[model samples]
Each structure stands twice: as C-alpha cells, then as structure tokens.
Target: MIAIDNVLISDEVVEEQFVCDLTKCKGGCCEDGDAGAPLLKQELDHLNNYYEVIKPYMTPQGIRENEKQGRYVYDRHFGWVTPTIEGQICTYAFRDAQNVIKCGIEQAYLDGKLPWKKPISCHMFPIKMSQSEVDPSMEYLNYEPREDLCSAACKLGKKLKVPAYVFLKDAIIRHYGEEFYATLDATAQHLKEQKG
Candidate 1:
C-alpha cells in the first residue's frame, strides 16, 4: 500500500488489480478534445522535445487538425475549453508489432534518455482538481456524475473498484499543496459526522 497526502491505499489499487479498461471503454482521457491538460514548465519542455521527435511520424491531416484548432492555446482567465473534445491522438500512441499502444516518452525514460514526464492533467483522469471560491476548498471533480464521455470513465472506475477518497486524495496532492490535504480530510470528517 502507498501513502500519499496522508491517505492510505491498498496495494491492489496501485497494481491496478481493479479492472479499469480505459482503452476499451473510453480510449483513455486523451480521446476527448481537451487541449490536453495544462502543463508545468518542465513538463511542457519535455513534451515539446517529444513533439519535435515524433512530428515526422504524425499524419499530415493530424498536424493540420491540431493547427486548425489552435490546440496549444490555454487561457488563464477563462479556464480550459469546456466539454473538451478529443484532439488528434498522439503520433506515438500507436500499435507496435505486438499491437499495443507504444509511447515514445515512456520508452525514452526507460532508455535513460529522458526523465519520466507527463502532463499532470493527463496523469490524473476520471479524478479532477477543482477549487471552490466560497470556502477556498479543493474538491474532487468526479466525472462519474457528469453526462457524456465522463460517464464512461465513472463506469470504468466502478469496475476497477476505485475508492473515491483514494483517487480524490491523489488528485488533491498533485494539483494543490499537501497542506490542502488535511483540510480536505477535516472537511470530509465534519461532513460525515454531520450525516451521522
């Protein structure tokens, strides 16, 4: 079991012992068109390198599509494009001779050529990071309750037997600071006691 943000998780969750066939159900979060997640400077730099390396492999139409949508633009004032549409799948996300999705970045990391890097947003899926204004509280945005594509994600989470708090805690720590974690814990406890 791993302890993150002071939340305990069973080893089963880490091993993905829970069956979550994201590929089978929703083709993973990237399928939807959400300019991909916001990236930290370091992650963006890494992605830019990967993008350059793989640019030649991408289909012409794919390049045109990405440019047409201006997919890289992010507005700090407006938040991300809502009802995110799935942009072009990555050029590296293709089947190898074994017919498996091959990621160049992951391979590069293994080869010691590049550090393991991925957009935080991409890393965390089905679980979302949201900030509340009234309370300045960090909350989990459970895609399960939403209609459209996220419903599929929700169903997948259920099949995986993913506990809501486990996923939620991870997201909080990833997006917010560790200090916010205890706040979330306290809030949950207070709500539970109120219910009881």
Candidate 2:
C-alpha cells in the first residue's frame, strides 16, 4: 500500500492493468450491480437540486423510479446511492443509439444544463474507495477489476501497457487532485525501478 496524505492506495492500483472497453461491456458496471451507483453528499445534493434540468435526458421509467424512491436512496451498505430501475439500470442512466448505457447526469453536463458531471463514485470505476476502518478520515483506493465485465478492458490495458492508475488518470485527478496524481505516478515509477 502507498500512503499519500489521507489516502491509502493499494499497490494493485499501479500494478494491475485496466482500461474500460465500453463497446464490449456496454456500461455493465451501471446495470449489473446489485446496488445503484454510490453518491457523495454533494452529489446527492446535485441530484436533488438539478433533477428538473436533468429529467429530460433520463428515461420515463427512470424518472418514475426516482419519483417513487427519493432522488437518492440511502443504502445500508453504500450510504447514499442513485436509485435503480427495478433493481436493474440506474435511474440516472439512459441507452444511447448504439444500445450502450450512458449516464443521464453526464449528458446534462455535456449539454451545459448542469455544472457537475456524474458522481465521482461512478467516474472512478474499478477503483473502489472506502473510509479506513482504523481512521475514518482516511480513504482507501483499491483496484478491483471485475472479471465478468472488465476482461476485455484488462486485456486491452495489458496490450497498451497502461496500469490501472494510469488508465484512471482523469478520474483520480478529478477526485483527488493533480498533485496527488503526480505523487502516485512518481511513486509507481520508483517502485518499478526498485523491482527492476
């Protein structure tokens, strides 16, 4: 594990290879999960505050589900999460012309209807985060590539020589910061050199 400020990152984040192959997975991470996408406190607020603006991008069924169960539901395990449609796709997800599932909230952001994009939890996929048991203020970022949905991505990453941390650069930088990402990249390079 690597300790950087308040975050503890798993070594696998720099060792394991991963790059999402959306054409193959078709956003299975959003649809096949037992629970909906997890949300941060601010993300929950975004859903509540901008639902009217984002509603047009969502499916009718998704809107209905959100209406039935509040904008964001409290999960016993995940705290706050976006509601799923009948335990299937997320209430904020929509199918594109290619039949690929996409995030409606992100669509709204792309259209300039909303300022924030989708939840950070969703943006940072394969790298799951949780508060450290020993220290609540600390967070852990672990690389957890799903075989069912990410096999192609894993293979592609290996082919491209991209580690999980490198593949998730934008998300990591967004969630953490540019300095955090720079430190991680440097640490990863140093570790590689030591092993060699």
Candidate 3:
C-alpha cells in the first residue's frame, strides 16, 4: 500500500487502469448494489439540505421510497446509506433519456440548484474505501473494477494509459485535498519510473 498523507492507497489504484463506461454500464453502479450509495457522516446534512431540490428530479418510486424510508436509511451491513427503492436503485436516482439511471442530486447540482454534487463514494468510481485494520480511523482506498459493468472502462483506461488514481484525481482531491493529490501523483510517477 502507498501511504499518502493519512490514507493508505492500494497498488491496484496506482497500477490498474479504469474509466467509467457509462454507455455500457448504464450507471449500474447506482442500482446494481444490494444497498444504496454509502454515505459519510457529514453527508447526512447534505441529504437533509438538498432533499427538497433533489426530490423534483427523482422518479416517482424513488420519491415514494425516500419519503417512506427517509433520505438516508440505517443498514445492518453498510451503516448509513442513501435509501433504496426496494433494495434496488438509490432514492436519489432517476432514469435518463437513454434509460440509464442517473443521480438526481447530481442533476440538481449541475443545474446550480444545490451546492453538493453527490456522495464522495459515488464520485470516486472504482475506488472504494474501507477502515484500515491497523487503525480503524485510517482509511484504505482500493481500486475495484466491478466485473462486466466496468470491463469496458478497464479496457478503455488501459488503452488510454489512464491509471485508476489519475482517472480519479478530482474525486480524490475532493476527499483528500489538492496537496495530498499532488503528493500522490509524485509517488505514482516515482513508482512508474522504478517499473521502467
């Protein structure tokens, strides 16, 4: 693992390549999971603040579910998560013109209706975080390309020479900070040189 600031990043992120192929996957990441998108502690407030604006953009089923279960729900496995539509799509999700599921919260943000974009977890596709074993407070970020759904992204990223960490630069910066991302980039460059 590459220790960057307080986060321990897995080699998969440094070595592996990935770029979300939304056309092929149809935003399956928003719905394929057993639970809704993982929510951070502060995101509860974002949900609360943005629910009103995000609601209009959501589907009927999504709205009903959110109204019934609340914007965020407590899950036995995932702790706090965005409420799901019958254990399927996120309550903040809606089908686009292409019939692909998209985040209503993101749409609202795109329209300049909300300050928050979406969950950091959702923003950081293929990069999932978990509590470190040594220190539960510390997070271990790993690149995990979902089979079938992300196969195209893996191919494209490999073809384009975009490593997972580089592809997820913005989201990582949003989570960590610009300085931390810079340090990570330097580390990745060093690793690449060593490999060469």
Q: Native-vs-model 2 lDDT?
A: 0.91
When sorted by TM-score, best at the front, the candidate numbers are 2, 3, 1
**Top-lDDT structure, candidate number:** 2
As a TM-score, model 1 comes out at 0.51
RMSD of each: 7.5, 0.9, 1.1
Score each candidate by Cα lDDT: 0.47, 0.91, 0.88
Q: Which stretches of candidate 2 lie over 4 Å from their true place?
A: none
lDDT of 2 by residue, 1-196 (tens): 9999999999999999888898999988888877998889888788889999999999999999988998999889988899999898999899999889999999999999888889988888899999977889999999887877899999999999999999889889998899999999999999999999
Candidate 1 per-residue C-alpha lDDT over 127-174 given as tens digits, one digit per residue, 9 for 90 to 100: 444444555433334332224645654566677766454555655576
lDDT of 3 by residue, 72-179 (tens): 988888779998887888888998889888899999999999988899989997899888668887988988878888898999898999999889998989989999
Going through the candidates in the order shown, the clash numbers are 4, 0, 0
How does candidate 3 fare on TM-score? 0.96
Off by more than 4 A, model 1: 1-20, 49-87, 95-113, 127-148, 156-165, 168-171
Q: What is the lDDT of residue 60 in candidate 3?
A: 92
Estimate the lDDT of model 3.
Answer: 0.88
